[model samples]
Target: MPGFSFETAERTHVGCVRKLNEDRVLSRPEVGLWAVADGMGGHQAGDLASSMIVDALSSIELLGTGYAFLDEVQESVQRVNRTLVSHARLSRPGTVIGSTLVALLIYDGHFACLWAGDSRVYLLRDGRLNQITRDHSMVQELIDSGALQRADAPYYGRSNVITRAVGVNDRLALDIASGPIQEGDVFLLCSDGLTGMMDDDEIEAVLKARTADDAADHLLKVTLDRGAKDNVSLVLVHVEPSVDDTLRTARRTLLA
Candidate 1:
């Protein structure tokens, strides 16, 4: 398995309506870890919960390659979940402090997507964009059960309600998906704040037209323009073949 290099960019905004931003974005390209956490529970608690998630992730040290690296990422997220639960019990009692998490980990030509709640991970490859994670929200459940149409989701009063999130329970159940890495692969990890305001097609269009940093900026601007009712956060990652690998291939070709 060959290692790759990543180009990453991230942004988080308080939004027009919210007085406080409870969303947190993590961009640790050196360690191949990136995530977006959207907090829920009110100003102080929500901000605390989201910050706890990113802080725990930022502390993760790469122990080994491949699966070992992925293990560390998962463990770190779970560790934070427990810490948040404990904190709520001891300090906030009866009030839930939780955050939705969506993370991307790439190592040794493999990529893993882990998430809970509505925050999402999207991949753009060969000019097509695909969503990698499903939302664990009330509206999603309704749509899955054929009780509600996807078009009407935004109009539902409880559309913002999530069914699963870190720190909301004693144990966190994250959905993990993995696949082989591809050069020119672009990944977008974002809080529901961005998705809630813009549909998948609109997001895909912006990502297709700009570089990682520009896409992130454009997405935030569009969200704000469209009435960003919630805090918006996003991380954009672009994977490419390592310079050493490319050089080696060129040298081999010249000799042959």
Candidate 2:
């Protein structure tokens, strides 16, 4: 009720190549929780890791207040980490299982985002697109330090090398931020399979399409057409004023 939006649409894809999809998307319109997780590991472990993170987040109820929303997210992520580590060690002692989590919580026209790895969130508004989360990958760090130019980003370093991830590290250090939201704005949560295979320009073109489901399907199609080498997942949400505002106001007046 606090968040803007009386409507929503969402979609997810496993891509073309990988037999086991290691990506996950979760959405709760009522609570204004939307997220994406991309997992990394060997022997089908990646699939397990990413799903674990999503399930953890989905299980928790969205808090009634904005400040409590992030706390719920943090606690849920940590619980998933412990669970993943325990599961991985018991089943495959040497195998490492971890995942990147990007989540958005909207309340009272404000948004809070948290990132653990390369999975990302984008804000599209007024014909412009902006990437709101900074990646935790090796290549991103190099770019931040001015050691790598834009031309060299895709190939300069082990672009897959992530500095932080849920379940891989004992003590997780997540990047969290918050901001305001506006009507007619769109938010995208996607795995690297989409970002890795498509550039920002290409993504913007597809995301600007008519509807969220259409945009999501088009994006997935583009990834597959590009020879998707990994699993891909996407969640698109549009922010519009709630249509029920007038009805709710009348009810409030009657009660008063």
TM-score of each: 0.94, 0.90
Cα error of candidate 2 at position 113, Å:
0.8
Model 2 agreement with the true structure over 67-104: per-residue lDDT tens digits: 88889888889988888877777875677899999998
The per-model lDDT (C-alpha) reads 0.90, 0.84
The backbone clash count of each candidate, in order, is: 0, 0
lDDT of 1 by residue, 118-203 (tens): 99999999989999999999999999999999999889999888999999898788999999889999999998889889998998
Can you list the residue pairs that collide in candidate 1? none
